[model samples]
Target: MSDKPVAVIGAGLAGLSAALTLQEAGREVVIYDGSDRVGGRVATDYIDGFTLDRGFQLINAKYPELLRLGVVDELDFIFAPRTIDVCVGEKRIALGDPRSNPFASLNPAAGTLIQKLGLVAYLLRTADAAKSVEEELSHLGKLYSRVLKPFLSGVFLTSPASVNAVIGKGLITSFISGKPGLPRKGVGALPAALAARIRKIELNHRIDSLSQFENQEVIVATDLTTAAQLLDIANVPKLAGSTTWYYEVPQELTGSARLLIDGEHRGPVVNSIVLSNLISTYAPDGKSLLASTTLDFASESEVRRHLALMWGAHTGGWSLIAKYDIPKSLPIFAIGNQSAASSQFSNNIYVAGDYRTAPSQNGALLSGRLAAQELLLDQGR
Candidate 1:
């Protein structure tokens, strides 16, 4: 291997993961990014003492990569209730986390007995499902629409039916094993934690070509589009996007730690949540923060209207903090590509990102680590 530090082009989670793994192996690394900060899509914005994330994001405590690195223990994680509130008409029908409280859904207001039974059956088979998410859940007539549809729409930022079952299986398995939650500082704290151990990162430095790193070992740890463009690849996956609206509301708005998803299926919003309820640090004292999501291009007024319907509360008085319209939020990959090789690129180059594996944080970390490990192995390090 060259004496020059390994060059990681991109300071996102994938790049950071690669840098960290290489450094841990006694290999030096230098990171370059186009942004002013380390995190790419994963970021936290602070406005008027409120923490608004780039999107509605949560760290699944049980993600294999996270657990492998002991990331959960590194952050001040605030967990939401292991429950879901389905908005129907003027009320919310609650459902407990079936993994921990199998009998908690017995309350008549929670859900039907058949629905509970079906959910159990689904979880039992979540790890080995070989069908599309929609196909696997099609048997549950009302279950998908009333509870799973809106919930999953938020999860995937697209129709559940269109997603591969493998992705859904991983999500379900993680959720069942551990609760997803936010860090005290924000989701960005995750990358911040990872970046803290790195030695060098050059921000606002974009690398348009791999030729710039010919003198050093390289890892293309950028997003799918950038990776394809940099590597001169032809095919690229379509990315799914969503708009998130952050509002600062009065503390009087009644909210629980559970996430709220629309059961009526009437408007653009797939899901909404009272962020401040789960973590008081997210908002200013005596105030609360609400984060809502929509897969379509919904205007602020339209989102507010949907919010009113979903939360059963007056949203007219809520103040808009910010709106994030991320067009390339996530990429769609082949169903079985999660376990594909991250080490086969030619010209002394390797790749890492969610697009190379499953579209999740776990995949990003896993891919980056795998790519770096493979590079080290090939060098006989």
Candidate 2:
């Protein structure tokens, strides 16, 4: 029905996936990325003859769209099943394979009572709490007043009352239940593979503003906060902020073991470190990739100081790979909030990104596939 190619802005996983889907459906699609590279947050940098991922990036094994794209086979991936050596002060909790640890089973009542209550509170904020994860707190009623509120604040690094319930539920369903895995080559491989399928990407074409064609359509697929201002769409869903740090540790110092520390850790930084050898083959000859995730409100100095402490305490003298800060890593998905798909705005225009489906390779890929499906359905194909 339409002759004009679908215009996908943002060459992240979502945009690339959407473009590929359109191409597969025998439609012309052109993708534009502001950055010189493809993957937005899902990025990797080649430095000092080593490849380092931006943040602690990983893919879930059960991500359906990722497996469907055929890129999964092209990329080398490894499953990080072990949740061990999660340090909390004196105790090193084995959370990876909790079943393997007899201690966790033996003592159900451990740690501070606040921590115990927090887990119970989090459980109450289950998927069925509201219609959507981004639902307003008012509709949540007692659920927010009693449990959902604080539980999410601690996890997402944002207040539950402020976070949209609809998005929150999506995060819980995708992350809490699913098994998260890492890529062998790096996070960039996933997007690179996706971009490879769609050869019409214009890099360094960061669109500052969109000129809405009267009949032609444009889909702005980006962060909701940014998307709102870009498209002049109000009530664009409220998203909380997040911060992440990328660091590499020497393998001779830290072995191939994964660590995930929660809020109750030390200082303002909720530090979680993972040994690189367990995740990627390109970590380094004798060096391990160490990734640390911190909360949004945390001070940069706090992260740097704590990181130095971690490295100093663990490794006597290790090379600091890079202390890079990612102010925004993951989208804050709250319950009950609904974002009108940009692609749905017009028959010719459509938006696709991880935010639309779920913030991962799976979500990004699915959003693209869904957009293409919408186009095809419109054509009565």
Candidate 3:
């Protein structure tokens, strides 16, 4: 290990993951973040005893990077159901095995058997193709509007049409093969747990220039925009935006832990989950927490009205606890942008954010570890 400490900028998952990996290899590491707290986008705010994540975020229980780090067992996780509910013009239809819910599978709006099978085949075939999801799914017919559009929009934080097809397939496959869940406390708990494994984290300390930390090796692990700004690099990819609203309802609207999608596209709300249904720790006793994700910002009344129409029940009593508008949430990785080997920006300065790899938690952690590995190899470790 080098005598000088490795300075890691941005205490988000990527930065923390890098710091932990480098430290484990006997390198001195120091992490810095502009915010008082860490986790970057994976944040949680406590308002009136309710835990509202910065945006609707979940962890794939089978994420290889997380599993390799052995952090999955450190935090309590609440898994969501394999099936998802889609609201098609006032009817909540389930999407999963027909044997489990035959009526939902029989619904005309669920798409015909041919269409569904075609979509599955296309996804599998193009899992490694360099096509945009929009171009790929457009060939599948009405299924795009009925199920794929609304559901995947919320997942990728952008229209499915614009996201990379292979990335989309990877996300869908991960969700299907692995259990997705939230920490018992909140999504922020994941990074917080990682941060605990490291020492010497300077909070509220933002880095403006790489020159400021003279002699110390620097790792930029912030979002795309911040990383570019700090590194003075141009041509950073555009980012996708998302807004999420957390509502407190007196009664549990959706009794199941399945995520609900807006099949009709009647309103801005794309998908939602009864947070308390997945984990009771999210809400106070006798109260339930409902979270909705949208591409644009919408008022509480607008969301409630949409929810009422979708569930066929009145949501006039639902109270908005917190609303998060993240304009630069996820990086828009084009077809050729998913390269892990190009994380090193220059000598002694490396980049490790979701943009450098896939735009998922696994990507973030993996990129971080890869960046650190590159540095370790350079140091002849």
Candidate 4:
């Protein structure tokens, strides 16, 4: 191998992961990012003493990548209940992870007793991996409408029918096995923890051409669009987008840490959370922070009304802290398509991103590790 240090473009989670993996293997690695921050799409904006993530994101401590990277215990993680609160017409339903809280989904609004039993049964009996999430859950009529659709549509940022069954499977298993939440510092703390281990990360330094890193192995760990542009690959998966609105409400108005979804599909906001309820540090003393996410952008008044409906409160006093419009959030996995998770782009040049994997932090980290390992093997290390 050449004596020159390995160059990693993009300081996102994928780039950070690749750089760290190579550094651990006794190789010199340097990272370059175009943005001022390191977390990429998982960034957090501190506005008026409130922490607003770039999008609605969660950190699952039990993700194999986070555990493997040994970042599970580094920061203070505020875990939400392993339950989803859905707002049906004129009523709210709480659905819990059957694996851990079997009785949590017992309410009639959740589904019939038989339907709840089928949820557990279907989870045990894995569906065909090459099916659409919609197809996989089509058997449970009420469960699909009342619980899963809104919950998943919020997370995936697209229709369930377009998402692969493998994604649905991953979601079910993670919720069953993992505790999903945000760090006390915010979701940005996740990538920050990973980047802390690596030595060199040059932010606001964009690498436009591969020829610049002369005589050095390079890893393009940028987003799917940038990665493809650098590789001159024209055909790539389409991207998904979302809009999130953050409001500062009175501290007196709060709810459970569980995520709230609009099951009735009555509004533009699909899901929301009382952020301060989950992590108090997200807001200032005597104040509260709330976030609502939607696939389509809605007016500020519309968002406030939708949030009020979900939280069952009057949001007239809620002030807008910040609003995020992320047009290229993640890749939309096609139905029946399998996990990409590929890093073997070329002999000397490699690519890593969630687009190459499953479109999660775990997938981003795993892709970086795979890229570094493949590069190491090719170099006869």
Candidate 5:
């Protein structure tokens, strides 16, 4: 082996995945993170006899690396029932099964004729595109701009139009196509398992900066904000922002995951509302659990008001398990002039995170793995 070792700079999904890949390839890998804990964004905290995830979180079977790790089986996943309620003004219609529901044929959004035809067109086009998964995702990216955007604006609690088409398509694939399964214990268990398999990890060491070495390789897997701090980029500072709330109620909320629209102008208020009992491990024998998220850019007052609307009457001292702004929770995956960070300095260096381009868990994981594989192959591993 060469004297050089690979250094993975973050312990989140990306960093862990990269480290694991490098380890498998027989590389001497050392993982570093600023946080005391190992799991980065896939955060789960135990509080008041409850497991609270950082934000609205879900683990889809379609996730390639997750499936590869076999952690899904170890956690004994509980499938969330295929359900979503899109609440519009006056009348709330269940979007039914994006796969098998006939509601689209009956109550399409536009005019009656247009809605019906649109529904038919959508189904036909979707069916046709389904033959090729990648093509289907590309097609949905286009539909996101047209159909899903206005509806998802409120669903994701942000402008769907602004979200990256690829990321939006992945979300649609997870819901309409992939099987949804959450950990039996909680999101924390998954990361804990990954950390166990990893070799060397340095916790509580915030990377102050990054400098190139002739033979050793450095992989910067931190979020944009942290990455900026290490790389000395002025624009990286602006990317730091995140908002999320985790609530551990007495018991599981008896229901399916609901996508609640504003019910007014239909602007994004909150993304998908999750019922944690769907994953039995989080809730007690008779209790339920739930977690929701808000945009990082929103002000404190704005978050409070949204919580009032979303929580509605359950605002009592319900054990605020964990609450804080991540500052760099997710990258802004919007259109034009949004933000872009890259590993352009040296061929020996690589950058991987949701901030690199796509801003989703899957993208982050895939980027990490890809960057590692690319580096390893380049080194003739």
Candidate 6:
């Protein structure tokens, strides 16, 4: 390995993962981020004895990269219910494994037996075929409105019509194949754990131009916009935006850990969950915490109206804890985007982020690992 130190820009999951991998391979790596703290998008806050993640995020235990990093065993995780609750007009419908909850199998809200069977076959086939999710699901006339649209919007952060089928299949498979859970501490704990293994990370140190470090080995692991700006690249993919609101209530509105979806697409609230129900440590002694997400900024009144529709409980008493708005939340994945391919500006410069891979935590880690591997290969390791 070379004695020269490597420079990793952005202290997000990708940057941290690259730094850790390079260090393990006997390379001295230095990480720098414009923010004072690490885990750029994957951030968490402590407020009034509650752990509020920047957005409603979770960790899929089956991610190969996460397992490789031993993250599954590093922190205490609270598994989310396999089934999801979709709020129709005035009822809540559960959908998932029938054995765990027979009610889900009997819920007519999902669709008729023929529609359900067709939906299953469609999802399975879509998993193998190279089609857009909207293109494939469009054939299922009623099922799209009843089941797919509301459920998928929460996952893709956009209408199901826009998300690539392959990405949808990957997310669905991850959800079904393994348990998705939250770390007791928060979503930030994942990157924090990775950051702990590194010896040095320069915080609040932004790199305006790569020209300054022209002679050194560099890996840009920032978000899409920032990465493009640093690399002076054009026509970068657009990103999805999201706003999450955290509320502390006197009592638990939903007793289960399952996700609650807005089936009707009536308003700003796309999905919601009682964080306290999933992890008791998320709230204080007697209070409960509810985290809800929307694609755009939702006023307090709009949030209350949506909650009232979903919960049927008077939300006037609920206390607003925090509201997080992330403008560049995720990279928009298109069918022909060169997502799986790595970008090499030169032999000593590389770009790594979720935008280069699938848009998920696994993709971020995988991209970082690939960047480090490319560097190692250059060093003849």
The prediction achieving the highest TM-score against the true structure is: 4
Q: 286 in model 3: Cα distance from truth in Å?
A: 1.1
Q: What CA RMSD would you report for each candidate?
A: 2.0, 5.2, 2.0, 1.7, 5.5, 1.9
lDDT of 2 by residue, 134-189 (tens): 24343434333323333344355555544555556555556555666656777788
lDDT of 4 by residue, 233-263 (tens): 9898888899988888776665577788987
Candidate 5, poorest ten consecutive residues by summed lDDT = 129-138
Displacement of the residue 250 alpha carbon in candidate 6, Å:
3.1
TM per prediction = 0.94, 0.78, 0.94, 0.95, 0.77, 0.94
Per-residue lDDT of model 3, residues 260-376, tens digit only: 887778888888888888898898888899898888777777888887877677887778888888999998777644656666778788889888778899989988999998988
Against the reference, the lDDT scores of all candidates come to 0.83, 0.60, 0.83, 0.83, 0.61, 0.83
Q: Write the per-residue lDDT of candidate 1 for residues 47-100, one digit (tens) a residue.
A: 899998899898887888888777778889988788888877887777766566
Worst 10 residues of 6 by lDDT: 122-131
Prediction 2 global C-alpha lDDT: 0.60
Residue pairs with colliding backbones in model 3 are: 134-161
lDDT of 6 by residue, 182-260 (tens): 9999998888888999988999898899887767889999988988898888878778888899999757476787888
Superposed by TM-score, candidate 3 places the C-alpha of residue 213 at a distance from the truth, in angstroms, of 1.9
Error of 4 at 310 (Å): 1.7
Higher-ranked by TM-score: 3 or 4 = 4
Work out how many backbone clashes candidate 6 has.
Answer: 0
User: What is the lDDT for 350 in model 1?
Assistant: 88
